[model samples]
Target: MAGLRRGRRPDEQPPEVRMTTLPTGAELLRYVVLVTGVIIAPGADLALVLTSAVRGGRQGGLATTMGIVSGVFVWAALAGAGLAGVLVASATGYLMLRLAGAAYLLFLGIKFLAQSRSVAPPVDRTGGAGKARSFWSYFRRGWVADVMNPKMAVFYLAVLSNFLHPGDFLPGKVFFLALVHASIGLLWFSSISLAVGRSNILARNPRVRRMLNLAGGAVLVLLSIEVALPMQW
Candidate 1:
């Protein structure tokens, strides 16, 4: 019954007071949209996608994007699967979770901003046929690349607070949130891919690729700043 620290936002009381009054589906929808929009906008994920585009070329960038989305899918899946307890009430618990989630995201963003790129592989006539990496290696790259990305965690936690309804079906809601988040990622990445398809503007210049990486790093730093700075509500 005691208020959790996370719920103790700048001024908002623990969820116990507000969640007792469940938000309407419309309100919930709005929250979901806000979360999705935030994810879609320029941030760590976008930056990383750019990095992939520059370093790995279009196909490699796309692979990295898929991996990024996949990571989000996993996080959402887990949140949805375990929603019964978190979303279903216990104001203290919800707030606590919120704070932890927020903190985690901020941590991820800062972490990524500080990360270094992996060593470049030697080019080959077949473009790595002789040295093709295994599926797991690619998978790992995608997963870790996105996972190490702190911006994603910040985005997930930040957006989640919007749609979460206390004392409701946790898995069901979190799953839906996941869908919204993942869908946005799909759209954003797809657009980048189209630009990548041009292959002329970005692909022609080696400098362009380096610039993209630098920009990506900058975006992530901003996302981290957004996450790390004090949050409202």
Candidate 2:
């Protein structure tokens, strides 16, 4: 065996080495599809976007969309920094985030429910005439809702690990995938916002608006309850 090994070329590579390259085109497509499915699934984020669009129109919905995307970038940065593992491993950290997120969702849901009963037209939360100020208000709500969810950190840590390999540059690849996720989210949610916002019939009809508010509020409240429950992860 020793003599045969010595006769072999020094430049010969092991089979394991063949698997260490960056994600192939097919792998990337698979990842994108997975991400899209996750984003499109009904969740607090979708509920929030629909409500914001109904209440504040396209600007509000787009602002909220940007906020959620920003949160996605933050999670990507955390993963790249290697902090996501710490979050996943720490029970206290996870519990605190879960509670805070649940509370925020509950509050938003109640507010929406209360507003649904009002006869007045939908108004921005800031009550300010400045478009920028109102935009920031909705934006901050979306950001807070996303950032408070511990599941995002867990998801990032879990999924990114599968895509990584030994000796590869971690941060760049993570960000690249994150960029794809964020781009898909932006496009998908923006389309939803525009479609909902441009509906003159829905906007003009109080009954329809009330029904949407009730639905959005109920979804948010149920999500909050779901989030508050103990997660197996």
Candidate 3:
């Protein structure tokens, strides 16, 4: 066929066709590593998971994890739509979101402190409407906690922006990145939940339970204060 393109086989392609523009394996690995680091870092999200696990057992922790994962995807969608940037750019919007998150955290901390003072009924370990209700309750808590936190919106905006291509399938790629992040979070938080669930010592010792509640509550209170303080985004 027109001299058969002397020096190249029929199946051979041009140098320009060597690879597609998609993310390479190395780049994907790097992204995974970076996301893993972010997932493992201590933050309000982790605190919420631990507290929920301790209070409600493995199911609670898992539910909360699901909620957080859902929130991550929501943020990703918002970022892909360019709404996250708009919110972050507006000081008043950011302020309101931050304050709302802080207020929720403060309320949770106060509840924990109050709980530490009194012996409430044992968490229902049976399966039924009660269990479903409890699971959804924790799920809502996790969802609200994540949604109210402006930091998450900013984080997704900053991180996902790096991998974005102006003309590519932007939302698909952004969601893929978020899925990676959420997968890491689910595994890590699930392990914590399992471990905390297995620790029956909390059920056995009131003092230890109170101590953990106090510690968890203190951490949330401190985080809330930190969140409320204005910072350069």
Candidate 4:
């Protein structure tokens, strides 16, 4: 014991991190439910997901869903961990992240708009089969995409903070919140997948697809503005 190193050595095995399971209150649950509903209520993330599902087939849509959910995980973690306050308060920090999110949303919106405008029937060249990216890669992409989204980060911080109490129980509350958020994300994304999996009616028609793309693009642009600009409302 006397000779043993106090700190973890480069090759030494790391201590196992304990994962605690804690219960939450109705208020927290309610917040989670409300946020889920809010997210479901017509926004760019959902729109892009639905469009991806419609155009790219099941995996593409699934990838987008996974990405979106991953984002929820990031946002929830940030909110729960106390980083959200700093993110929302500092003009420089907030603006930087906000702009990054806005740029991403804008790019996605423009890309979809371009896709919608193409004269030739758009190719689903997500590379016929063999070129499909790794499943994890897509999942990570979705998670990172949402994680980087400032609207969501700020939204959770400003709105969800009301339900959270400052105490030892906070960690537990955040965990529960993350679970609820992720579940909502999966539920919504799966619904899109099932709808597409069910029929070619909406997905196959160029007219419907164009509408979906344009609508999604518009929503994203709106979200971008909301993130980038100050809002009294």
Q: Give candidate 2's error at residue 54 in angstroms.
A: 0.5
**How does each model score on lDDT?**
0.57, 0.86, 0.83, 0.71
What tens-digit string does per-residue lDDT give for candidate 3 at 56-137? 8788889998998888888888998999999999989999999999999998888777777765534685879889899899
Whole-structure CA lDDT of model 2:
0.86
Best by TM-score: 2
Candidate 3 shows a clash count of 0
Flag clash pairs in model 4: 67-142, 67-143
Clashing pairs in 2: none
Candidate 2 similarity to native, TM-score? 0.87
The window of 10 residues in a row where model 3 has the poorest summed lDDT is 15-24
Candidate 1, 127-184: lDDT as tens digits: 4653245323434556664554444444555556666755756666666667666677
lDDT of 1: 0.57
Best by lDDT: 2
TM-score of each: 0.56, 0.87, 0.86, 0.76
* Model 2 lDDT-worst window of ten: 13-22
User: What overall lDDT, based on C-alpha atoms, would model 4 receive against the true structure?
Assistant: 0.71
Model 2: CA > 4 A from native: 1-22, 123-129, 230-233
| Model 4 Cα lDDT, one tens digit per residue, 183-219 | 8878888788678745676645778777777777777
